[model samples]
Target: MLVDADDCEIVGEANGSAEMERLLIESAPEVVLCDTSPADALRVIEALSGEGAALVLLGEDHSEYQLMADAVLPGWAYLRKEADRIEILGAIRAAGAGLIAVDRSFSLLPGSAFPLADAEILPPDETLTAREREVLQQMTHGLPNKQIAARLNISQHTVKFHVASILAKLGASSRTEAVTSGARRGLVSL
Candidate 1:
């Protein structure tokens, strides 16, 4: 595919990290587009860390989006190599503007989850009170405040307080975010 070479300047290309590092220092481009597997992408991402040029990775495996998205930051994205010229170009433009452009194929929206490996586990919140843990357990069952209060034999006000504390400890802005974060940390199973 020509990818309409006229759309943007092709600074340079490299086969691996060593060559890419040299090209990065020499060209100092605004955004770097890489076509590689998720494993290979990790090496390039590490090499380009703090190098100033934003990255747009085009990985071959769709299931690796989580591992790749874990590396997400301003102007950093994981797109599919099968992305068309428009999608690729749009990602490049977004990267240059310090914005992220996640691939449409990924179901990575808020509250969505991908199975996590044990080695990639997040830190569990050890600061939660026993009562707070109980509240979180109820939350995983989608219990409303009134129901939770009934189950825990606590006042609705007390339930709200525990919920607020749970959110704060999990660094989540919403109940769903809290639950997702909680599950990721093995605080709750859902």
Candidate 2:
């Protein structure tokens, strides 16, 4: 018999995270096999971390959450949905033993969901912090510093600091130019 056959056979199947929750409580199997969107995977792992089972996440190679396996999945195993049978079995066994398992293909970049093997999508400004990226998201919306500050609940001065940093980093002489440049480079939405 396949070592994975027993637990894998009757594991819960849900097309989305909500149904997965109900399935988790009702079936309560030893393992869960799922194909979830990046955000959905985060939610499922958050919900199921302390439940009495291992979760084997199957996701496409480029799924964003595949990059944060450590932080999101404390004790679960995560692997590319395209793994061969042997590798899948190994992850299942490791997860069953209560150890977190990860595919070797993931990277260590914080706040970046891009896979290690792929080229990085550096926001024209390599020096920008993740917080500033949030600011840029608002800037792309044509919000002024005061409005961005109000929406982010940060002080206007802090927003100005980020704007100055963003200007210098992107080599833009003004916020409008920065927004235009950012939109061109896939850094922010127009």
RMSD of each: 7.3, 14.3
Per-residue lDDT tens digits for candidate 2, residues 1-190, read: 2345554465546878899889889888676766687768778777676677677787754354444343433346667877777877777777777776666564222333322222324544475787887898899888988999999999999999999988887778988998876654446544
Q: Which pairs clash in model 2?
A: none
lDDT of 2: 0.69
The TM-score leader among the candidates is 1
TM-score of 1: 0.56
- Total residue pair clashes for candidate 2: 0
Clashes of each: 0, 0
Enumerate residue pairs that collide in model 1: none
Worst 10-residue lDDT window, candidate 2: 108-117
In candidate 1, stretches whose alpha carbon ends up further than 4 angstroms from where it belongs are 1-7, 62-74, 108-190
Residue runs of model 2 more than 4 Å from their true location after superposition: 1-9, 60-74, 107-190
